[model samples]
Target: MDEFSFCDKSLSYEVRVKDLIDRMTLDEKAGQIGDTALGVPRIGLPKYEWWSEALHGVSDVGQAGNHVTHFDDVIPGATSFPTVILTSATFNQSLWKKIGQAVSTEARAMYNLGHAGLTFWSPNINVVRDPRWGRALETPGEDPFVAGRYAVNYVRGLQDVEGSTEDDEVADLDSRPLKVSACCKHYAAYDVDNWLGVDRYHFDAIVTEQDMMETFQRPFEMCVKEGDVSSVMCSYNKINGIPACADPRLLKDTIRGEWNLRGYIVSDCDSIDVMLDAQKWLNDEPYYCLDLDCGYYYPNYANTSVRMGKVKEAELDSALKNLYNVLMRLGFFDGSPKYEKLGKSDICSHENIELATEAARQGIVLLKNANQTLPLKSNKIKTIAVVGPHANATSAMIGNYAGVPCRFTSPIDGFSKYGKVKYETGCGEVFCKNESLIFPAVRAAKKADATVLVVGLDLTVEAESLDRTDLLLPGYQQQLIQQVSSQSKGPVILVIMSAGGVDISFAKDDPNIQSIIWAGYPGEEGGHAIADIVFGKANPGGRLPLTWFYTNYTDMLPLTSMRLRPIESLDYPGRTYKFYDGPTVYPFGFGLSYTNFTYKLVSSTKTVNVKLNKFQHCRDLNYTEGSYKPPCPAILIEDLKSSCGDYKVKLEIEVKNVGERDGSDVVMVYWSPPQGIAEAPIVDLVGFERVFVGGGGGSVKVGFELDVCKSLGLVDFRGYRLLPSGGGKFVIGDGVLSLPLQINFRR
Candidate 1:
């Protein structure tokens, strides 16, 4: 096998993969179809496992033996970071990339120890369309732009080549070797896990073309085109009456053909079995003859399908080439890895663990700080009360898709550092079902100088296979919070730890509850991060990635409705911050800081002109005319793509810290369609940046350059991106600052 051309290190990956496939028999090639790829021992190839997970860290949840394990002399764990939902709340893309880099470093170290695989399926780029969806904790947020940006940054960090360009050009990506293969997944409109009577295995997501292109598929496309991810896992559910794995339009045409994905497509674990039993997609004589009547392994079905002419061997070769390409990039066939010496020292280094704590600090949002209630003066507040279900929580701090951590700092442990801490489980657990337990908690709060109520949902109330029925707190939790706050001797500070948004309107309105913090399942150092914000050790700047809706939202809208636009006749109010115009407990991008910041537009382009060819319809229309002339026709942005040369909108805004405390501020810029455009969102986030400013009138300038077609256009009902000829506004930082802009066509 060493004499074969496939073993030549100098050959291109495509050439090597083709040479290897040509040497394999049909059955041998078929053996490579499953998650556990059975390698040909005769050719010196080793078995490869493709099911390892690295969502936020090197997790132990995959079927492959790729997991962090405790041993006598080896490292006991990996650095577990905060969940994706909380990390996205930071609005700091650089930090997201850094976390991904750290995770991949540990993953490579594990691989050297024979405990991990090269391909890590992770950074779930699915948009959290519905807050109640059980897996919301695993997603970026509701906005396609945010999800797309996260996919690009995180995937780049995970699979970074030593000398690759930051732009990730296709040529450079194809020629380079990857540190680790990163996959952006559960591809194409997969949010619901289990809701009411519908389960993910059987549910058919009837998505409209507009929503599919504009919202659902946008992130996956960016993951492929921009991130150059090595793999994409098809979802379990069906999209528009077709199983995602079997749909040629999604897996073949869109992902590979349109976006030019340089990776293989994988199933979402036993999805073939789901297709056979749950979906019942294959019900014929040939399928029945393949040993379904008896007990036949599911992976062997691929072998039978090729012989039955259901799938061609040439197609299998193509898929194998894609898979082998990633393996080659990871140096699996290059004799030995350069970093084979990486081991225990690199697994949970001090720097990695510190980054986890910093991530928790940056992502914890300060929801309310009425009359300067937070930053409890340590000198004055001698005795503090930390009461609630999560005050002493350890495992609950780290959300799902996690590995064991190096250490833990519970809320009680963190607050004890500042002053005397009197702790109590407010009502037995987060459910707060036992009314008897409330009395002891109230007594603890009454004696302390300040009270910190740590309460909210957890994995039991909302997780995989569990969709929340209502947005309110669990049983008696609200009662426990209200009672404890009323009896407390001093100001009450509320700390909520959960993946999904909760209505908590009662606490927001209560004057006794002086401050509120939303720490969305912060990682192992969550307690320390929460304590940092409460005592002014760290200033909170994380914004809400998903909207905090009122209870009436779930009452009016069903979880199954996959619509982004409002239906006036049906009284449907829509979804996400993009299209939703209804009332919210707290809107998207809402958060408070210890210090306040104000924005001033330094410079910006007033208008952008798209030079059009002679065949364009809108080229002759008068775009400058007022109400007298007919409105210029909407033009498809795709047609103008070729003509968009150096046409972009550049803006520079100065941010001034107005308060007397140093803090970080997220500058979010949102773009709105022309006033009269039908079915347009209220506003869409186009660009954002998180900046740190010092106390006492410190200021800095933030710059942004946006492509006209990519950032300013809106998707129409027919799934076409259109740029309307009218006036629009660019809102900055919660509508505090605004700038007018226009788009016009020139022949």
Candidate 2:
């Protein structure tokens, strides 16, 4: 054996990784790509697995990890935080960062105990284009920009070093060691579930280049550039005509080439195998040249394939180098003393529990509160009835990808906090009904002073591979609600314990039902959070992350349609809040708080060409032959608007709590381009801020400034961003305020 400097902590990560790889046999290199890595004992490396998950909290499966990750596995468990969909609803990136810290801290604890890995597959930042996606709960909804913002803050919080950056440290991820890495998932366009006789697993997405650049790919780019994400997993579906794992433009060109991202690209669970089998790209140039050791691990663990002449070792080493860089940066090989010690008590520390509670409090979206039906004043309400399948059911309380709850708090426990609470399971099966339970549930509801009906779908009804036939509630719970509401003498509060949007037209029309709450599979502390909002202890400030569409739209809009931009001819059953213009039960960015907020636009400015007819003047000065010598340098391309990368925008706005109670409001900045400007989504999201206001008498002024050329621009058919030239209006506070943007370009 020879002495090597790879063990020296003083050496650079590149130098250390080079030494480590040089010592490994070809068999070891090929074997290391899969989830499970067989250690080379000679090098002092230990056996490890890459398939660990920490979606909300650390999830462990003995061997077949993903198989058990999405289920509720324990009580008094890992301080189960709210699902990703719930986190997105808060529209509070700061809160998300806190949750990220808690999760990564627990992740490190798990890693120390040999139960989890340091590299966590989490913070699924895929833009939610279609609401019907079974895994919409796994992603932040609708807008690419919002998702991008969430990705950056959340990733920073997750991968934070104690004193490295001031912005990403709040909750405890680690005392000093670098936090567990967060991966931005499904690299390209991955937004749908099973549809059109084709599942997402093998779906070939046909997308326009302009839409691809300006729309779907925006969030992934932001995740890399802003978040500095550690890893990126390719999607199961094909982007244009090739599988995402094998698409060189996406992997080598866009990610590795254009953006120069340093992260490793992992194939989404056996995606590489599909590339070889279904897509049949075994002989194709890019696929043929794929580096098998870059986590392009074959499912069968056939390392002998490295001997094939299809690909170059240089390519394999280049790809493997990226993975090695991430591992080295994480301090895996250096064996820093900071990570040597750990204990079981770190799993769900008190601070971690508080963070979970805060997440649930912020994630609870108050969908409807007609006539101020919520905030059940304790003195006025003596008796409360909590009735439904989810009233006491732990599984329904926490949705898929949930950690084992440290303490499962059911609706029964929540409503009972105020005392004089009655509870009953209104149904048996989530998707079906037991005839016997409804009668007792209705009787309990009628006898109580007020009824809190907790009902909605669980993972059984919609999860990993589960797809719903419709958006309606699964069981006789709706019938129970109507019956109980008709009989109850007081107001009935309908609390939905689910992730995605559900059609509740029956409750919407029935004046008997006074309030609606989308609890969104809130974590273990969910019970307490729901109770706080209901009892007026905590004001509900969460807004809808995705739109709630009417049932009729489901029939008209097929799930298979991939067109993101609007097509108005067929009544424009377009996807997402940006494109759709039809009726929605609750629009995107909609939520009812205990208070109201008013917005006033103070001022705004934009950049426009100050030189009078600068393009024509430059053309005349450089005139030669029939056309200008080489075309005006200032005139950019065919469109002068494309050249103005210096275009800037600035604005200030005042937000006051106009309503009675203190609350927070999301200052949504929606933008509409000048009419006949170009083909784009109507009134898309430009910028937003979750601003807080004091109740009855509080007001605060918030300001924002962005480069119009890069921050806000329209990509044409050729992928050129058209900077704002003509005057445009910025809709502030949804409809509370409107401001004019004046422009003058410096160049």
lDDT of 2 by residue, 649-745 (tens): 7788888898778788877887765444445567777777777788886899888876565555666666655444445677775666666664433
Q: Model 1 Cα displacement at 101 (Å)?
A: 0.6
- Give the per-residue lDDT of model 1 (tens digit) for 486-534: 9999999999999889999999999989999999989888898899889
**After superposition, which runs of candidate 2 have C-alpha atoms over 4 Å from their true positions?**
61-76, 166-177, 282-306, 336-342, 568-572, 606-646, 743-747
Model 1 scores a C-alpha lDDT of 0.83
TM-score of 2: 0.90
Colliding pairs, model 2: 76-406, 77-405, 77-406, 608-744, 608-745, 609-745
Question: lDDT of each prediction vs. the true structure?
Answer: 0.83, 0.71
